[model samples]
Target: MTDVIEREIKIKLDIDPSQLVRNLEKEGFEYLGEEEQEDVYLNGTVKDFRDTDEALRIRVVNDKVELTYKSPKMGKDSKSREEITVNLDNKESMIKILEKLGYKSSYVLRKRRISFRKGNFTVCVDNVEGLGNFIEIEGIDVKESDLVSFFQDFKGKFHLNGEPITKSYLELMVNKLDNSNPN
Candidate 1:
């Protein structure tokens, strides 16, 4: 069995989620889900960032609160996903709590994520639920697991599942809810 760990860290981004989506497409990435994840996603993409041999995930809006569990990938056909997740509600209010807690909202496009070992954690990436893109490596790190290691190590990372992942669920919902850009 492989040693694994579970942990998550979310931050607010400064980029226009839609613009980030466009940049991802220009780099050969495409949306992977428009249905699953949680029904919040509007434009999700399976994108790899610049200057990398493999894809680096860059989602628009992830859930404000999330939960995760990790263990091992087991095998190629491992059905369990080896993950456990819990998503909190009232994101608007939670953001206020997060702000008070001192965790700065992030601005780096591909720099936001919750990492696990051996592929297991899942939740809203960019506010998209049921289905969102993901990346994972195939190894174990326990003595000192780095949160960023998930992106740094495996390099075997890939999109989660489904079709046409939204660019930004917020904007998507906004357009649907109002039919006009908020900004």
Candidate 2:
């Protein structure tokens, strides 16, 4: 298992995806292909992951599978956290093992992600199944100021005027489900 600090900022995209791709290309971001991803979030029996603000997820992308644990958000501004991930050979077996260990599946988030890279920063345009389109700027082990500045510059250049969303996809999905099925 390898551990890394993941820092990212998410902005809801209001414009067309093709326009965003054009903007990225004009800014010299290299296309990195696209992939369909499914993330299954799990909850521990001993503790509520929502209350603890931590997450355990099993992610499947094409034929690859990974088990990841994300610590609580580190700061108030961005989604910075310690992420530990292990590549797994079998998704079903891993899910069973986690279930046996008292972790139960909570939610599944599916999205189609188109990726682009320009330096240490990787940009992803995501079309979530139930949610709307979003753009995420991710940096690994980067300084907070640098990440923030990069996002600010990118936002200004791309004419992204909306406020950044700080909530995780899981949080957003949960809230959406709760609101839709208020009983």
Candidate no. 1 TM-score: 0.25
lDDT of 2 by residue, 136-164 (tens): 99999988778888989999988887887
How far is 101's C-alpha from truth in model 1 (Å)? 35
Candidate 1 on 1-183: residue-level lDDT in tens?
222332332223234545544544464443444322222211112321211221111223354444233333233221112444445566445445545654333222232333222333232235223223333222223212343344333222332232222123332334454555455
The 10-residue segment of model 1 with minimum total lDDT is: 48-57
Residue 82 lDDT in candidate 1: 40
RMSD to native, candidate 2? 0.9
10 residues in a row with least lDDT, candidate 2:
72-81
lDDT by candidate, in order shown: 0.32, 0.92
TM-score of each: 0.25, 0.97
